[model samples]
Target chain A: MLARVFEASGLSSVQISLLREHTEKIRPPRALFCPFPFGLALGKPNDPEFQHRVLDHAFSLLERPSGPVLEDFPEEIVPADAPVTPAEERPPDPAFELTALRGYYDRFVAHHGRTAVGLTGVPSTRFRGLVRLLERYAAGEEIEAPTPDLSAAQYARFACDDIKAFFREARMEQYPAENGPQIDAWFWQQTAMGPMMRRVRDRMLASGDRQVEMLSYGIYREPDTPNPEWKYLTPTAVKTDGG
Target chain B: MPHLKHLPDMKRNEMLTFPAQVNHDTPWTPPARPLREARLALVTSAGLHRRGDPPFVSNHHEPDYSYRRLPADTPAAEILQSHASAGFDRSGIQRDLNTTYPVDRLRELLMRGAIGSLADSFYSFMGALRNVARLEQETAPAVAELLRQDGVEVVLLTPT
Candidate 1:
C-alpha cells in the first residue's frame, strides 16, 4: 500500500481506509477503517462537522507509540437521502431541468464560493442551449462543435462531463441531505439525459470507435458500477404530475 | 466499500487477484511528535489534478504510475477528478470534494493550529491500480522525497 511506501521513506502517516479487508491485508503502519460507502472517505459530504470528526480520528492514530496499528472508526453514518425509490414524476427534459436548476446552482456558487462546473470552457449561463445541441448528437444526429478548436466528438465528451457536473452541483444545492449514490441514481435512472447519453455511447461503440467508446465510458458511466445497465426507470416508473 | 464487493463481474474477477500485492512486509515509522505540532499534508488516491494537468491513463491493461501535485490553495472549481474505475461513486466528491480530499477541513485545522501548518500542495494518484509494484518501487519514494523536501512531517491519506 501507498502508506507503507511512505512509511518506508521515514514519513509517519495515518490513512482513512474505506476497506477493512484491504487494510487488514496490507497492514499499513496506522490506518482507521471507515465503514462508509465507496468514494466517501470522510463519510457525508457538505457536513464539515462529520468530516472533521473523521479527520480527527485518522490523525489521532499518529499518537499510538507502536507499529502497524489499525483501528475502526467509531461512528456509523446514516445516509442523508431517503431510501432509493422510484420517482413518482416523469424524468423531465434537460432543457426544463437545466432552466429550473439555474437559480439554486447560482445560490450554491454564492454560498460555496466555487463550483465544479466549467470543465468544458463553456459558460454556465448557456448550458441549456449547449445541452440541447449536445443531446441532438446523443440521438445520432451529426452536429458541429461550437468552436473550431475541438471536434464534435471531443466537444461531446467535454460537454457530457460538464453538464453532469452542473447537474450534480445544482442538485446538491436543492437536496443537501441526499448522499452521493442517491444523487447519481437520480441522474442515471431518473433523467432524460441518462438514456440520451447512453444512445451516444452505444452509437459510438456500434460504430467500432474504440477510442471514443473508452473516452465516453470514462465520462458518462463507471463501467464497474451498477449503473448504465439501462434497465430501470421505465414507463411504469413514471407518474402523471398534473393533468 | 459495498461498491467494491458488488462490482460488475469484469471488475470483481480482476480484484480477486490482489493477494499477490499484499504479501509485502509491514513497514513501520513512529510519529516524531503529536499531530497538533506536526506539519501535515494530504495524499489522496482520488485521481484529482488541476485543470491543465494530464489525466491518468484511462484503461485497465496499462496503469499510469504517475502522480499529480495539487496546490492546497487551489479553488474547488480549478480541481478536476478523472478516475474512471468501475463501480466507483464519484458523485459524493462531486458535491463536496471534502468527502475524499478534505482540504477544507485540513485548512480549518491549519487555522485553528490543530496542526502546525499544511504543505503548500497535496499529492494525488488514480485508484484501481493493478500494478502496485511500480508505485512502490518508483513513484512512492519520489513523492516521499518530495514531501521530505517540503518539510511535511505527517500525512493523512484518503481514497475514493
Candidate 2:
C-alpha cells in the first residue's frame, strides 16, 4: 500500500514480496516475488553474499520501464540436513537453565524496569514454566506425550519467543530513545541473556538436536560450499510463463 | 507450489479475506535519471524500528497506523523486528536483520555505485495492518511526504 503511495507521489518504487499471488493481485508498481520462507524476503540470514544478490535483483526492478510488474526469484534455497537428535539423547545447556534465565530476567527488570518487558504476554510468574519447557526441548526430551494442553515443541517456541521479546523490550527501556547500532550492540554484547541465548544455540547446534535445527531455521550459516542449484529469476522465464 | 499453500489453517482464511486495495489507476513514475544517479530510500512493512524506538503495538485491536524513521546509516544490528504476524517464518530475520530490511545491502550498493545515495531517513511500518482506510488516509500520505521531503527518487519496499 505504501508502495503505491510512493509511486503516486512520483517516486519509482518496487516491493520484495514473499507472496506472489498477493503481489499479483495488489499489483504494486513493481514486485519481486522471493521464493523464501516468511521473514527471509531478502535472502538467507547472515549470508551477506546471498543477501547482496537478493537486493541486487530487487533494485534492478527499478530499471524496468513498466508498471505493475511482478517477477519471481528463480533461486531455490534448500534446507541443509543437519542431524536431529531426539531430546532425550542430548544434554541441556546448563548455562541457559530455567533458573539462570529467570535470574537474568530479574536482573534485567531491576535495571530497566518493566516498561517494555511485558509485551510477550508471558507473565513473570510463568517464566519458570517457560524455562522448563525450553530446557526439556534443548535436552531432546519427548514433550508431546507428557504435556496435555500443549506439545513440548509448542511450549519451547513460546518460551524462546517470550524470552527474546523480554530481552528486546528490556533493552529498549534501557535506552528509551537511542541510535539503532548502539542499542543493538548493547543487546547482543552487553546484555547477559543475549550472549546466553547464543551460547545455548551453539551448544544445541554442536549436539545436532532436531528441536534446535527446527527452531534455528533462517539463522544464516555460510555453507561449506554454495549450493549449485541457485538461479536468479530472469525476465525471460517470466515472459515464457506469461507472468 | 506456492508458499501460501503451507499456511496454517487459521491464516488461510485471513489471507483469502484480506481486503487488499488494488488501485488500477496508480500512475507509474519512472526514475528521472539513470539508475546510477537516482537517489534511493528503503521503505518496509516488516515492523522494523531502531533498537530504542517504541515498537509497533501488535496487540492493538485497531491497526496501529504508526511508523519508525530510521536514519540511513543505522547498522543492521541496531534494527529490531517486532511484528507479531504468524503468516511468515521469522527465524532468519531474528539472526540477521538483512533478511527483511536490507539496509546493509543498500549501503553496499551505494559504495559500489550500483545506485545513487540513500535518503537521510528510511521508513518502516507493521505489515499486519488490517485497517486500510486509516492506512490510506493517514499513514501512507505521511510516509509519502517524508520521502518527498527527503528528495528520494526511488524506493525499495520489502514487505513481510
Candidate 3:
C-alpha cells in the first residue's frame, strides 16, 4: 500500500515483506518476501552481513525495469536455527531476573547509546509498576490498566513487551552471541514471563471484554499451540497456507 | 506456508474473510538512476517515532493514519516503536534497530559507497492499519511529496 503510493508518486520503492500472501494481494511494485517471522523484516539482530545481503537483494530490484516484482530471498532464518546452550541457571522470578540483568542493560545503553524499552511511554524507573500489574494479574486478581486510555489486557500486553525487551536487551549484552529468536524462545517458551502472561490471557478472557479477546492473543503463546502467527496476521489479510 | 492455514478450525474462516485490498495494478517505477548517485530514503510501517513524540494510539478499534518524521541523525535510543499489532515478534527489533529500520546499516552503505547519500529524514506509519483508504489517499501521497521534496530517488520500505 504505502509502497505502491510511493511508486505511484514516482519514488522508486522496494519493501521487505514477511507475509507473501498479503504482498501478492497488494501487489506492490517491488517486494522481497522473507521467510522470517513477523516483526523481523531483516534476517537477524546484530548480523550486519546478513542485513547487507538482504539490502543488496532489495536494491537490485530497482534495476529490473519491471512491474510489481515480488520475489523470495533464498535464505530462511528461524529461531530453531540457533544452537541452544542452557543458561547457568534459570532465575526464580521476573524481579530476580530483572535485578540480575540491570548491570548488563546499563552497559548496553552506555555502549550503544540507546534502549528499546520505551513503547509503554512510561519511564524506565517507573516500569516496575507495570511489572507489578502483570504479577498481580497472574496471581488471579482484577488489574487496572497502566495507562488510562487502554484496557488492562491492552496495557498488560505492552507492559510485557517492555519488560521482555528490557530483559532481552540485557541478556543480549551478557551473551552477545545469542540471536534474537533464540533469546525470545528462551524468554517465552522457557521463562516465568511466558507462563505468567499465559495466565494473564486466561484471566483477561475470563473477564469477558470483547476488546481484550483480541489484545490477549499477543500476551503469550505456548510452546507448540496453534496461536496467532504474526506473519499473515496483517491488519486485513488472513493467510491460508498451513505452515 | 501461508499463515492463515495454521489457524484453529474456529478462527480460520472468520480470519480468512477479513478483506485485504487486492490491487490488480500494483504501481511500478524502475531505477530512476544508478544506486550510487540516488538519494535513498527509508519508509517503514513500524510505528516508530522519536521518544518524546506523541505516541500512536494502541487502540484496537482504530488505526492511526498519521505518520512520523525521523531525522537520519536521531539517536538509536531515541527511536521508539508503538505498533499496535498483537501478532508480530518484537525481540528482533528490541535488540537491533537494523532488523526493522536498518538505519545503521544504511549508514554503513553510505560510507562504503554501496549507494549514494541518505535522505535527511525517513518516514513511518503504524503497522496493521485495518482501514487505509485515508492512508492511500492522503498521508501516503503527502509522504511521497516530502520524499520528492528531499530528492529521494530510491526508497527501501520495511513493514512490521
Q: Highest DockQ: give the candidate number.
A: 3
lDDT of 1 by residue, A104-183 (tens): 88887787776666556678898877778777887788978766755577667767777777777788888987766677
Worst 10 residues of 1 chain B by lDDT: B14-23
Ranking by lDDT: 3, 1, 2
**Candidate 2 lDDT tens digits, B106-133:** 7888898988788999999887554556
DockQ for model 2 equals 0.22
Cand. 2 TM to true fold: 0.63
Write the residue-wise lDDT of candidate 2 on A104-176 in tens digits: 5566556533222332346766765555555565555655523464434434444455565555444444444
What C-alpha lDDT, on a 0 to 100 scale, does residue A22 get in candidate 2? Answer: 64
lDDT of 3 at A126: 69
Give one clash count per candidate, in the order shown.
3, 7, 2
**lDDT tens readout by residue for model 3, A1-243:** 888889888889989987777788888888898877677888777789999999999888888876778888998754344345455455567666667677888887787778878767777666657767888977877777655777666677778777777777787788877765567667765666656667777876555554565566555544443433343356544433210
**Candidate 1 per-residue lDDT over residues B50-125, each given as its tens digit:** 8767655543334667899988898887888766332456667776889898988998988898998899878998
Whose TM-score is greatest here? 3
DockQ class, candidate 3: acceptable
After superposition, candidate 2 runs with Cα above 4 Å error: A77-96, A99-243, B5-14
lDDT of 3 by residue, B1-160 (tens): 1254554554455334544677788777777679998899999998999988866764434557899999989988889887734356676787788989999999999998877899999999987766777788889999999999999989999987
B-chain TM-score for every candidate: 0.87, 0.87, 0.87
- Clashing residue pairs found in predicted model 2: A74-A233, A87-A139, A87-A140, A87-A141, A88-A140, A180-B78, A218-B92
